[model samples]
Target: MKKIALLSFLMVFLFSCGQQAKKSETKSEDTPKEVVVMSVDQVLEQASDLAEKEIAVKGTVMHVCQQGGQRCFLMGSNEDITIRVEAGEKIGAFSQEQMGSELEITGVLKEVLTDADAHNPGAEHGEAEHEEDAETQDAHKVLAENQAAAERVFFIEGVTVKEL
Candidate 1:
């Protein structure tokens, strides 16, 4: 009788442990997925369709354009679509210091229609804010809001930055 009781208790303990492990595995699989990762060419191909669309892409950081203490642009190889980052946003996860490094950027891909969007002739990146208007400032906010609506771009908020 004593041997039977011991065996039953052991079986129950083992069964509970197995159930707990299965539950933990299910929880891990439930983690949120990331935005569709695209290559530079694929991103450009879908750029028109993705206007105002939040995108995440990995590419080599051809250059880093900095301005206004903390503002910076993480340019991909094509130089067509650069990811704009703000002062508080510059934890060095992506910036000029990261030039020549490969990186993954997640932001709202926008069209550079105006001259202001064009590169300046004579200014090192990280010098000064070109346009301090409410419009430009709001642009950053819009990007942030847009990102929030869909998905978290970088899993680490800012640390997920990849230098391609």
Candidate 2:
């Protein structure tokens, strides 16, 4: 009887240890992945898939926001593709001289709708909507122009930038 009890205890302990290891495995899965560095073209190609994920992208600083330096546009190596990088809490702003410089930026990818009401198909485009006043008509025209621009824009919320 004593031997049987010892064997049963060992079996229970072993089973519980196995379950504990499985729990640890699940915890690891819930953890975030390590950051990976990518180029502008690679990021743009997989933009949708990489949304909300932290990544590092290397590009040339094409344009930095002159108003507040809060945002900068990064161009690909070939100069055809561009990705916008926005200053995050850690990154206060980008300097003007950063333009024309190659940089490796680490940040989370973000996407924003340029115009939330982009081409509202359900809304009627009748003259009644724009006939309120001349100002209203001008506003409508501006809104139309804005809508015709990029419907959605993808950018990176920059965290760190390293000139290379």
Backbone N/Cα/C clashes per model: 8, 0
TM-score of each candidate structure, all chains considered together:
0.42, 0.58
Model 1 lDDT on a 0 to 1 scale:
0.57
Candidate 2: C-alpha RMSD to true structure equals 5.8
Model 1 clash tally?
Answer: 8
By summed lDDT, which 10 consecutive residues of candidate 1 come out lowest? 151-160
- RMSD in angstroms, all models? 13.5, 5.8
Q: Rate the local accuracy (lDDT) of all candidates.
A: 0.57, 0.85
Q: Residues 5-100, candidate 2, lDDT per residue (tens digit)?
A: 999999999999999999999999999777778989999999979988889999889899999899999988676689989997898999999999
lDDT of 2 at 164: 93
Clashing pairs in 2: none
lDDT of 2 at 75: 89
Residue pairs in candidate 1 whose N, alpha carbon or C atoms collide under 3 angstroms: 66-125, 66-126, 67-126, 102-163, 102-164, 103-162, 103-163, 103-164
